[model samples]
Target: MSPVAGTVLAVLLSLVSAAGYALAAVAQARLAASAAPAGRGALRALLARGQWWWAVGLNAAGALAHVAALHYGPLTLVQPLGALTLVAALPLGAYCARRRVTRTEWRGALLTLGGLVGLVAMTGPAEPGEALSLREALIVAAATGLLIAALASGRVPRRRGDTGTRGLGHATASGIASGVGSALTQTLTAALALELPGREPVWWQTALLAVLISGFAVGGLLLSQAAYRGGLAAPLAVVNLSNPAAAAIIGVALLGETFRAGTWGWPIAAAASLVAARGVVLLTKGGAPAPEADPASSTVVVTGSRPVPPPRATELPAPLPAPLSTPLPLTVPLSVPEVEPARASIPG
Candidate 1:
């Protein structure tokens, strides 16, 4: 197939993967909610769900389709197309959950997809290379460092009274794993194909690829579950951005992919990334926990009228008047009055 046709195929396959991810997420949520207390069977239970099985099958099909597309096109082209899964997963999750997704979600998802498509289209295919080098190792290491930093920051935010923080935590981990996974997959694939002159992949290279694929599958499952449970915008954005960002960097630095758009392409890509990030932040903010109600300020009904009952003899304010012209101020003074000694313990 031509490169153009391969790109199209990759995009279509990504949509299939996205649908699979959404279904798997929902299934994982259901199973997680119903899992046994022992926790020994949680993984099994999650995998046991029929919906989860469907998700796995769909994802595998997507991976195979992606591989086929890559054979015809480029990694820079194909990997970015895979980000379309985020677009597909959101609406699919909403529909399956029997909920109507908000306009904000649709806009965010679409913008994310558009931004990714642009970023990928700009990148040319990977250079045919056989083996990993020290320079590539250093680059991967730097990316990994950034990933770790993000995770640390996510944790700190959660610790500081951020109740909606789990989503961020989950997203961060997912993003790092997805990004590294995609990059490594590319590296492994190129190596195993014997693309490099005078080099061939040994048993370890094949084993490594197997491990990476398994990790990607499992991580993708949990991440999708977390994303669907948390809502699409943030998790999807993180995954979409991180995976391609990692892949794009590798494509440019190691695989020698480039864009004719010049310096502007870099900034545009960064801006698009931030836009997606803002959407996630907004989604997370919207899901924050509400403040607790103050029972003291609340009104209680003692017959027809709402009133604050007087304290008992043991308590202060015995036989307090009811239904006054104006409700007695429930405000608490800084200093307590000596006369109302028993009531002094309670706030004025």
Candidate 2:
């Protein structure tokens, strides 16, 4: 087929893949909610579903289409199209789930797409390549290990003061994991040349690729579900920006991919990405109300509204002998007390 036709096919496949991912995310969210004791296991259940199979299957199909596109058209064309998933997924999720896509979400999505398109258009096509040598591989291993350690250590502990912090912490952690998974997948894909399936293909490469794909597929699915549960904008921001940013950084630093456009292009792209990310954060934070300062206090206020007296403080009370001496006369009223109006106003 002609290069143009191949490129078109690739773009279409990319959209399909995005749809798969979006569907997977929605399905995972539902499973997580329904599966008692929501956790990683819900994600597993999500992936186990027939719908998930379709999602993953479409993803694979898109990957193949992408590979074909690489053969025919410029990488510049195909890579940017991958970001189309955001545009596709949001609308699809809204339609399928009856979820509302807020104006902020739409804005963020558009900005993200525009920035990606601008960046891809400005940068030249990528030259297909393979993994680094053992030395470089070691360096990457060390870096990834350090990142993992940091991730582990960076827990937002649920302390005495605030439970709300816990949600943010979880979302951030999930976002990081999803982002890292995306970055690694990109790296793994580049290193392994995923399409080269043969009888004697390198087992390590194949194994690593499988792990990466599974990790990303599962992590992304779960994280997105969590995002919707927590609030969509924050997680979406992290996944969308981090995936491309990580890939771009690695592509430039490791793969030696060069930006052919004037020096302004890269910086402009970066700036736009930052803006889009900030917009997402703002939108999410705006939607989620701040937690009450003291949960206990709020509880007290709720219970206090009843005519019942507040619970006795868990402290020793004065002896009963002293309480018996405090007999007081009670006065009874013949009628309910009347409330006096401050001022009289004419009816409208």
Which digits, one per residue and each the tens of the lDDT, describe model 2 over residues 271-304? Answer: 7666665555554543344455753344334544
lDDT of 2: 0.55
Worst 10 residues of 2 by lDDT: 334-343
Q: Count the backbone clashes (under 3 Å) in each candidate.
A: 1, 0
lDDT of 1 by residue, 1-348 (tens): 676776677666655655555555445444433434434765676666776677567656666776666666556666666766666666665676577666666666666676667666666655556334434643574566566456635432424335434565566666666666766665666666765334565787567565755665566556555543444545656666666666667668766667647777777767766666665665454434456665556666688776865444565543344534334454345235654787777886
TM-score of 2: 0.62
User: What's each prediction's TM-score?
Assistant: 0.67, 0.62
CA lDDT, every model vs. true structure: 0.59, 0.55
Best by TM-score: 1
Candidate 2 residue 36 C-alpha distance from true site, Å? 3.7
Runs in model 2 with CA error above 4 Å? 38-72, 121-126, 152-228, 282-348
Q: Among these predicted structures, which one has the highest lDDT? A: 1
